[model samples]
Target: MSDLLRLLPWSGPDGRRCYVSADSGGGPVSRLADRLEELQLDTGAELLDHVEELLRAHRVSGDELRFCVHRLAEALRDALRVAESRGRRIPVPEDEMEDEMEGHPEPPGLC
Candidate 1:
């Protein structure tokens, strides 16, 4: 494993290891905020409200919440990349694409 992977908490059943990316450790809400800032999105308040709802629904612990936030952030980043590659405008709301991503998994192709 690379040095960065070595730094992650990698533990699971039967001595198997699960590596959480550095970004994933930051939780979903924070991740979303960071992505929005990067993309210069205008709907920060709406996105934050959605994240808050999710957090409340999950009632997740701080650490677990952070992981979820990170995943959401990464998902947003991936979505933005897809949009950009297609020559579409970014900062599209997560609600607009969340259903699509959930229903249609991306091929294991290179970005």
Candidate 2:
């Protein structure tokens, strides 16, 4: 018997993180979470494209920009949580990784 739990992407209205117990992370609910995460990431990408186009326009209203940013942030949070539940880190660019590692070398023998 395993008591492992996976964190769901969305939190409760009370601001508490929600979790679902699964013997492994491949159960039905886990699969649903994975799908939702993918959808969120796709939505976020679309929103980013919209933001880029809006920025290129001669004039974009403050409210429109704010709404786009808020939605994009929400989608990003969902995608991040999904990755975390799967015990994976979102891939970072190699240059960014090197910058992060600078002055933060891994302990010897602990690669």
Candidate 3:
């Protein structure tokens, strides 16, 4: 029985904040949140890959390029929010190891 509330990463459909009342951050709801955050990170990685390809191919028009960039920005924001919520640094997914290793420090447990 605790009187503390935990912040969730996402807002409600109506754009309102949400909170969960949990004694510990290891319950079913917390597990679900972890899964969701991982998914969001993965999706952001995918979006980044797609955006890179699109930029290299030079196939998108002015408006389409703008839209793609917007989506990419949103994806980055979502991934960052997930990392913040989990109190961890933004984890570069395995598929991006080559790019990350170029100039960034290795993520935890990778060395």
| Model 2 Cα lDDT, one tens digit per residue, 3-110 | 346677767777777677655567887788778777877888888888899999959899998888788788778777777766633445779967976997432220
Q: Is candidate 2 or candidate 3 better by lDDT?
A: 2
Q: Which candidate number would show the highest lDDT if scored against the true structure? A: 2
Cα error of candidate 3 at position 50, Å: 0.5
Per-prediction TM-score, please?
A: 0.30, 0.65, 0.64
Looking at model 2, which ten-residue stretch has the lowest summed lDDT? 102-111
Predicted candidate 3 versus true structure: per-residue lDDT over 12-80, tens digit per residue: 777765556545578887777778878888888898888888889977889978988888888888877
lDDT of 1 at 14: 53
**TM-score between candidate 2 and the true structure:** 0.65
What's the true lDDT of residue 95 in model 3? 79
TM-score order of candidates, top first: 2, 3, 1
lDDT of 1 by residue, 1-111 (tens): 211211212124654533333334366643553454445343434566667887778766798678667766865654554344323223346797566557765332111
TM-score of 3: 0.64
Poorest 10 consecutive residues by lDDT, candidate 1: 1-10
Worst 10 residues of 3 by lDDT: 102-111
Q: What is the lDDT of residue 62 in candidate 3?
A: 93
